[model samples]
Target: MASEVVALVNPNTEAALPFATTLQLVVGQATEKGRKSQNEDAIGIRIPSGLALITKGVVSVISDGVSTAEGGAHASAISVSNFLADYYSTPESWGVQTSSSKVLTALNRWLYGLGQDYRDARRGFVCTFSALVFKSCSVHMLHVGDSRIYRFRHGELLQLTHDHSTNINSSNQYLTRALGMDVNLDVDYKTLSVEVDDVYLMTTDGVHDVLTEFEIHQKLTVLCQQHSTLSDDLCEQFCLMLNKKAFDLGSKDNLSSQLLSVSQLPKQAIDDVYQSLSSQPFPPPLSVGMKLDGYQVTHTLHQSQRSQVYRVVNDQGEAFCMKTPSVNYIDDAAYIERFMLESWIGQRINSTHVVKVVELQKIKSALYYVTEFLSGISLGEWLTQHKKAPVEEVLLLLKQIELGIRAFHRRETLHQDLKPDNIFITREGVVKIIDFGSCYIKGVAEISSPLTRDRILGTADYTAPEVILGYQADGRADLFSLAVIAFEMLAGQLPFKGKLEKCRTRQDYQRLDYISVHQLNPMVPEWMDNALKKALNIDPNLRQADTCELIHQLTTAKANQTVKDFVPLIARNPVRFWQVISIALFLCLVASLLNN
Candidate 1:
């Protein structure tokens, strides 16, 4: 059952830089069934492309099924296959630890359930599992049983994972933990930074138990010294030689070894990235009655420093909005790339509450994208029209906007720049989110790029404090932004009232005052105001966990109390508070004058 399957290719775009800092891995593996009835070892690897590479990362797994198991080979195959498939399917919003752990836990429980059906554990599905995930600039390892992951770098060999076994004897050891050994499973996890030209090795106990660490170190050192970079074929030969040496040392177990050498890492240079992004000539700004690629420009819709939007109609008389990149960024490819990304995101996200990208059937002459023309007013305009809108109506629009935000979150994306100007209120009372130029996709963010957008892209007043402080933004950041919109919709004003701009530090953010929603708009109930406060907390940690939680609280009714009960008199009515103090002082002065 031994098979030769090697060469896990990194599918990200090839670096144009001569000295790129991107990760490029060359992989090779060899497996053997040395004197065994069937090979019970499995190996698998995945190198994702583009955004997936950043979000899900590259993975390599090795498993060794217990010989005592009835279907040992099947167990090994299932363990490796299921893990790789499920790991990629996990939510991108989650960190590697959370995503990988959840997948492994579910897989472990399933394996255990299958084993519990058997009278003897040995007859059930059982396997040792070890996996390595290469993500960002770090390597994450997960292991159970006796399978191992190793790193060989700079003429030194380092064991990355500990074996989950106890020595019954020198010749016979017992697995203390495995995938199907019990209902509860404990998987060892570790993370380490990665450097270019580093070699990673994954092996079964069949090879590691027989070869001493010193011998393994010597062989790897010699290979490294002989060649700066080993070819795929040479790596495969080295792995097979290790297996053969172990077999010659009186080991009869099935053996497997996988080797991965990082050849390149993403370069910090921006020139190449800019060249790639600005390859296309910037489209000329279209004016009214102009024609381009059979689309007649009817009128200019919107204009900004980044791009220009025009209402256009094709020969078929179908109306659409053509968005073209601004000439200001004709040489700035990173900005152009982001401008194009907005259209890409618009096309993928399918929701009535989100703008839809019009499919371009014919080749375009310039760098422009077309989307369905929306016959609706912007949320900003709607807010201006209804300064004191009813709470029920505002909630309806907010709920729809929340749905649109959810669509982004479900795909592990965040609309980093969510404001009233980016929201649309249709003539039919539908709310839709527009402008994905500032969106952040977790997977896309991981892939190394020359263009750095480390600063916050959102409006400070509506953006989460964490984002403004140059911290990584998650779905909670979007929640905070949405809460700001909701607060504005209900109260016709911001909660903090420009206080965020003054918040240069975390302490400043914490000290900022929260004005009660009811004080501005008595129409909003106390519960709704409290809910908005929780969602709009300056600290992301103090905010609601998710949109669902916030929406639930917003809809939940609580006992109505006086606004003064929750808000200070000075904050609620500053003028009235000062007037009361003045009157009291004047009364005391008049009484003193009468006594004199």
Candidate 2:
């Protein structure tokens, strides 16, 4: 049996968030062989020190090897090692759920494959797994098999995970769901808000099955009271004592336990974030054939006041597009912050519909990032090529864009800037959404930024009215932008002719009339126009809730169009019907005048 303790402190004196920096934790772990010939249980904790601790947070994993399986100890060790390793390497833009789940899924598949190669179904690489991740102010948990995670706070004990075991008989139980047992693995994930003084525990089945929740709580309470004040030594001793007690209770399997106490929570400080954002200076502008780091500039792909994109080739003859901050706003801290965030967001969002940001092999010169060169035409150009596209074709493209937007939404990010130019269609008919410079992340928004942006970040024609009205936009705003794009694709024009930027008030927006798509393109059905109207509603509350709803309305709109068949003639053909009525009235007046 052995016990270890690790402690951390707030390293950065300069902070970026508005709140004071206070996130701290104390951790302790212990493992015991018990009566087993060898200990097959593995436990590990990674409490990153600086920015990593703030961005990625802390990770702790505990895995229990199947006693009857061969190489179970090795399997448990690998599961913990691979999970912590891959999780940090994942893009920081990804939420904790995404990063943790992806790493676990890949780890599960590897273990299952190894088990299949062993050719022994029962004695294969199998184990139960559970993990706890403390990031920012939230604790995210991922679980599989029978390992348990528990929270003990203020005399109350809460079990955070469910066991995946089935009782086969009174004396024997089997894991219903575990890594290496199936080709496909399902992981349970959840998140909880963290507060100071909270205590969390992770235990392998060997320890948890023997020790009741009340017993564990009592042990934790005693240790906390003895310390009077929290310390790493106290936590370490408590973990060892808890594991030893479990073994004393006649636990025959390898035992492992981990304890974590929240000492502080992270807060965004304006200066700290500014310093991190402005750590690197902007690179100078480059000309064709100019060499930067190892990249040779081949062409100028794009140029804007905010950024410059260049097609570059590396020493290995691989092509990439390097985007650098525009020198025009080099001194603008807020602009630089958003520019850096654009790179981070690009790296985080993984979708074929979105552009891929490549990781450079070596540190590059200045502050810039590279991306895979996409050989495709912008949606704007595609629109010019295929004006008045069929509804089906437009729907297909819109669906792809929606998928990309949903990916952003999953990460709690909103792509505030969505327009025809931001979308691309590859030669193979693959549609992608690009340009995340104007994205808004919930986490980032919570931080106190150095600059306050009063201006809208979206294009005038495609921007939702709510944004123009100085309100915070959400996923529905992105849906509105997509709706406008869809309307342009089908009708070859915007739903409203006036500029949104010019509408400073609600009444100004209300005065702008929505033009029927059917009037622009007679091929457009009334039902389709109705769908667009709902999506393009000046009031965001009236717009479709999400892209999926909009898609459903657009696809099933034909049924609604059928209802238009029964409309009164005056309603359907008001122009022709009113013209006949006017002529008849004129003849009657003429006859009356003649008789008089």
Candidate 3:
């Protein structure tokens, strides 16, 4: 058997832009040529967005279809690639309504069924599929088998996808899973916001198996410099170089490579450069009696059950809001450790949609952190006081919330607790995300305990179905909560409102009906309603697994709506209007007197 690899990309179609579709693919023969063949694949596409109704993108795959007793390998490979090409040509909305998981599952089952009915059971044909979808500044990946995806950023090549191999006990070399191998299958999918100048490479075992990570990085550095004109040419040259190197080293396997080089520099690097030239030095620490870190503290913020928040100076110096433990977290030691972990995680995250942490300090017993002083009210409080916000405002706020959360997802972190109190709306109409004390990093092992089991960590009203049942938490759980929040934000009521503690039972949680946003606000787009329903699904597997996808959907919906959909509801709530006006008048009077 031999290894088969294919690489394809949509070339830069527009003359004004630097963006181009680049796919580098390779296929090689294995030692036991008759027993097995290499099966590697890839796909790419441009999804619809407000920025571009028709996105320009590419999809490419290299698969060594299993050699069947009847020899259907070539046919199978052609079928898979052609199907993907046709699929990518259609609008993204026309595909599976859910996430990529469902799409891939369906594709796998369909291929597996076809192979089984061919009457060539002895001849097995399976291939590892790895794909990259790039559009604008984002990249989505779908992969399986031993093929790998690597990103070269900051002058280094970092492997992005994990290999599923049967040789885990030894060389970790056998393919444990592949499309068309079985009736049931699972696929790993992820989305990343790309920065210009970041290089992405997807390759079969031929290149990765022979070269060390360091050696690969070195080659990438040299190739990046030499083949700067044509990304595809660079990848081809690199593959040829690796093959020669492997043969020289007495390697005995097929060699293949797929490389993608992004020409634009990453936004982070640009931002860093700007900051280096423009940023001022950090201001000196405040004296004990001095104020203006934003919040007015009547007393020090104190720790509670699993969290603590403090009251501190506000900009006006007459009011206050809460800050939380900078150190000595009152939560269990593990929980307390999360505070520091969150700080570290926060550094990687940057989004105006999320609550902003102002500063962090480590004092003996007074270790405390500062953040924007939210003066208006929490989403929960607003809902209680004014019912639901105007449909437009609710949707706008939800968009902001999703924007912040999507930023976190870009950094591979999840806000495990996303309830009403955690969502704050400032008096100035800014939506602020709060309480990341329970956030978790994706792909990282979480601390476990009896208390952590099936026990809910967020407010009962907004907890997802899985969390209520004591199931493990993940990005889906956060999506579920976001759905609930969206429901409450529009409907002026919790999706499931009862005794909060009693709702912890799985059955009780499952019984709640998520009020459709459209039902509450007719102006809400149907697409949004559908997306929210999918997010709030009781079956975690059925829900939107990626926050970035959800954000995209919500943003599209918001953009599709009319101006009336965003009109502020404050005018309809006399109480809120009066309060805001009264505060403003008071400030105005104080300023006038000072001037006189």
Candidate 4:
């Protein structure tokens, strides 16, 4: 495999102000090459305001150096990265038109001059360059040499830059264009409209020479499924995987890849465009005389930040919850998609333990989702009113919750956020797990934003250890959360408590301790104690692998009683205790008299 590096830039250009653009670069060499032969360098700059001559948006640049029979490649690459970083850091004197292009040309000349001054320069410490500049609705890319730039849209691949290499026969090659090759350079530049879900990739020959474009595309698709946030760690992993793939194919040269993804359309411009498109008159609310599809919105049930839930009645007078995006989010395409996804996933998962979605509806100016209305109190209210249920009852309720979660896990889904409020219990003792809003289908993880990692999605107290550590959460994380809820149910208090209002940070959760629950509830059985301990283990690997095993142990242990349950006969009744003592004293007196 060949080593690859990937990154994602925020689509909200306004919000991405400080950095304006993001950059990532990685370099890899075969094990046979003992020392670092080449270096990867990256630079990012925010184009100053009023610089219309230059691009007004962000400019990101990356370079990968490759040298044969010389050690200057590493130094040359680092020098260029540092120089560009400094040049872009200050206010630019040149405007957007040619300011950026001019700056790059100057850098190119500097590299050429440096190479001419050194003896090893004759061999040429050449480097491939790729840069992305965002202005208004478009992105411009400049490229040279074997360093490549690729664009992906809707699962299709487009190679944006062609390699500049002269083939002598089959294997021997000479560079046609590169920075530091001569006193002058011929750079390839292209401009195109930037759209949401578009991804750009740039890499050194190390990546392209080893892994085919198809192979690189496949790995990117896989990585997108597991991660929504892009980081240095993820980039490193991508690079390592590529290098591994390249080595397997017998590549002996250095390798590197840089990937940048555009997750969302420019939010402001896109929102404005969507609003303009949806400028039609709103139809009057459905009246008693008119029908919408087949059901009537009998009344509006509730309204929240993102959407509204309505109480609807079918022609037969059956009730259902019809949810529609709030007017504010009506033009918000991303929110609409998320709402639809939640409804879709909820409908796919049909279980008594989960809330059910009946159907999805799209009307003028709005999208609606119909679901079954749950008639019960939320677990949060139940906990507050009941304080704590009997230990046995708590155990039974926990078993029910665990079984419900197991059902989801079996379907290869993980409820990313599970908490008391999202769970409900009817008066008839039926448990319904509600809120698939934060639920994620297993094996599909990538989303639009890399900043998603910074946003904590679930309730603080219930998040798992792995989640806190910024790892991809699975069914085991859910089990850890369920264990916390179990502990709270038995102890009448959370396992972790502090002055903080919520356990949002890992530090807030350090207060959790197993002994605390045991101290509060002495009636807790030894078997139950051990089960909770194992379930709440900080290390996910040490925790119970399956929730089914936990349920079985708790049920079986409840059935069996051991010596630990025994109490002295005298302790059961004080009067019986006195009589037994008196009889013992009389027997002792009789023995003494007989002996005399």
Candidate 5:
């Protein structure tokens, strides 16, 4: 048996998070042939360092080769190796499930192709695979076939994976699903909340089938009593002991086991999600040259009813933009949470076209966040300065903005409040997205909170029709907003003749109309205008799949509309799209009430 340990330490964990405690873990793994002539079981653990350690977290994988297959051993080894390598190579912005699933899908395809050399794939390369990913405060597990995953918490051992093999009898059994066994792989994915002192166990059937859960619990309990920690030596000894027991019990398969001990986990309560900043008192209204936490307010850039922005400079003379929630919302839980979410989300996103959220250097004495300041003018301001920009320049600006939006989308986020006023263009012509106050994060939204966390609407003019119609929105909603911006930039007017903002009901949406860019700007090509029209489709279903596709159409002349379909009231009487939906909903409500 062999053993290794990986210890993770995040230097900026607290700076990036509101909580002081970060994810800390101790990992140990072991494998042995036990009564078998060769060990077809493979177990490996990868605990990356640096930023990846924080974003991708630690991955532990195990695979059991089917002895009946000619290349079973090779398949198991390759699966384990490929998963670790490919998973880490995926974009850091992707969530754990997306990154792992895509890697596994590709890995399975490669292995399945190799198995085609045999008349029966079962007689070629085949293996049962299981992987445990420890990310932030959650554990994501992916499984195929009979390998098992378990968790030992608070002195109890609980099975976390199900066996995929069917039990016709003790002497006869067959795997229902496994990697490289079929073209279409159906893998099970499971996610669980993690806490301190949690020890997760992964094992092959050689040890688990021979030992009941209770027996495993007893053995785990003894290990806990004997050692204060799941150090490399202790974890290796535990695996070796399990292998010996299974061998003595007449087990005939290879043995492998892996252990993960969660030593520290961030605070779980939503209120504590950013407790440090959220608990800080809102700073008093600032005047020019006023200093707070060593940052001097050189100028108040902008102030709205909801928040305030100021250009600030510190001792090092570094220029930055600081944003503060209005004192009016100091007692508003929802608003405060939303305000906090902006800073939290900003700290994680990394894109040149996106304003960078600066990590807090000194202890903050007030409720505010800082971002790198760039000398730039808002897109709205720029639009007013130039009535109609060159077609090439407009496309260039749109392309940069798309990059920023794509960065957010890659992280499963949506800039719900996309608009001209919320975007900035540096003197160098670099477009940077700001104002994440209305942004939506898929992972963060799943967190439990007692406060009524609602979708705060963005600017009505740029907000998608679906959002106004009270429908669930995704990236398409943002695309709709981007399309509106693109249209406004080209024609120097709103698509529906500035009537979209007045829309309230189905009738108003139905009355909506589009003003072609060529009629106003004349310089916009027919293809570019068509692309913008498609993107501004009132129905999200009809809009471009993503911002990149929309940008592609504008830059590529051949990307022309190839099909025709009836758009609802919005396309014809554009203002009527919003009204049609509201009126229909109102009539439905009346009918239901009368029927009741």
Candidate 6:
């Protein structure tokens, strides 16, 4: 019998960050010219509501103008204002770090270009910037100057940003790093957990450098109290007093201060929903003429021992694929949770190359979910027709696959089950990755669960050796699988002559040798074959670090390429290999002496 299909929606709408979601924030900021003619410092705070609040979160930034620069004020203002605009403008699918980094990189370049007309670039646009992104219950911090970010929590105040200036004879210091100082911007970045009632303080050097850390703590202690409510009046008063206090403490430079206090955070309920829905009983099987909920089944696409997929249409005549879990494992809680997460993960990943989970407007009465129906052929089926596709064609398709995989990676997800069957080429020639039953979400992994989540996912033929041996899976695992697919496309057969699937142990995998693509297809170039071989290495550490590197190797060959027939024992680490050999020999000698 087919299980009723109902796509589970994550409460946050977007997948939650590593922890927490839907943060409510109260913010305030104050700035002063201090004895300067113009306030060369800038500050801003943005709190988005609704789904964006969960995905993009709140952003706060402060930038300090270089004291010696001619356009410090303009530079500071542009950095903070443009960052606020560009950050949220970036694809919502991007992680906080990625979005900020890209914006900063582009912002720096634009600022640097503005100063190119002036002699002695230091006399032009330049500033130090510090930013804090509060998303979910996590804080992503990015800094490039002496501007400061601090957190007041549990009755204690902690500084979160490092001062980038180096001391000159302990008496004086000039800025060593600042935005627009060079063509490349190197910012310090990190992610940390944020708790309810957590208070964040941002400041320019005019405030932080003059006022002692103790003084800042005193202000935060009075401004932030234990509660789910935020005090705008008190928070604003704190910022004004902070900037004024710095000026009163013999400060001569422009000053700015910003405060943000978390009022409430969404509770961790991702796994709870899974556990609750998992208790729902499996529905009886349905045929082509039968209807489950509003979806009317038109054809049974595929059926397996674990699940069944069918083409169905809604009352509006919109086509969709309804996937139902099999009744065989109705009592298996872990399996059911994983099955539910499949749709949840798909909803978070927004990419043209990925099949999206469609949310039916009607209420579901059963346990099945639906996805977009595509009139296309699976990569497995396409491969059967074109045994030897052109090199350019394979590279183009592989890049698209990599692009799709990145959409999941951005959400801290891993498509652990990646094979030709899980990939589809739509009628318009778009490559779409489908099926997330074996996917891993880093945030979900952090949640403590009694049930074992790891048990070797994906087909053994393409699974990384580390994954098979119970090691934590990462991007390298996906890269290995991608390489296997690449080899299959070029050679029309699996590498290692299909012996990889039989590997049940480390020794078994060690015994298997990789079959060169060149041996199977002479049309393949030596450099391209070498690149594939490296990606297909049994030892994942020996493979390309990422898909980008693999793609580069495939598209651009080395000046003097050398083909390696196999990955040597020393490929992973020669020093470690010799150290193990030395240890083994010494142990053998000790055994011989004991026996004698």
Report every candidate's CA lDDT.
0.79, 0.79, 0.55, 0.60, 0.82, 0.80
Q: Write the per-residue lDDT of candidate 4 for residues 234-276, one digit (tens) a residue.
A: 6656756676677678765665555566543333334333343
lDDT value, residue 184 of candidate 3: 83
TM-scores for every predicted model? 0.81, 0.63, 0.43, 0.45, 0.70, 0.79
Model 5, 108-174: lDDT tens digits are 8888999998887568789999999887678899999999999998897788888999988978788
**Candidate 1 Cα outliers beyond 4 Å, as residue runs:** 1-24, 46-58, 67-72, 83-113, 119-124, 133-145, 164-194, 264-269, 454-456, 557-596
Error of 2 at 344 (Å): 4.3
Best by TM-score: 1
Full-model lDDT, candidate 6: 0.80
Off by over 4 Å in 2: 1-22, 118-120, 168-170, 268-340, 343-414, 421-437, 441-480, 495-596
Instruction: Report the candidate with higher lDDT, 4 versus 5.
Output: 5
Question: Where is model 4 poorest over a 10-residue stretch in terms of lDDT?
Answer: 10-19
Q: What does the lDDT come to for candidate 3?
A: 0.55
Query: What residue runs in model 3 are displaced by over 4 Å at the alpha carbon?
Result: 1-303, 313-331, 359-366, 443-456, 496-501, 504-506, 509-531, 544-596
User: TM-score of the candidate numbered 4?
Assistant: 0.45
Model 6 per-residue lDDT tens digits across residues 409-479: 87777788889999999989999998888887764553334455545379988787878888777788898
lDDT of 1 at 38: 80
lDDT of 2 by residue, 522-552 (tens): 9877888888888887767767788888888
Candidate 3, residues 354-386, lDDT tens digits: the string is: 766553332212223455556678877777876
- 419 in model 6: Cα distance from truth in Å? 1.1
Q: Identify the candidate with maximal lDDT.
A: 5
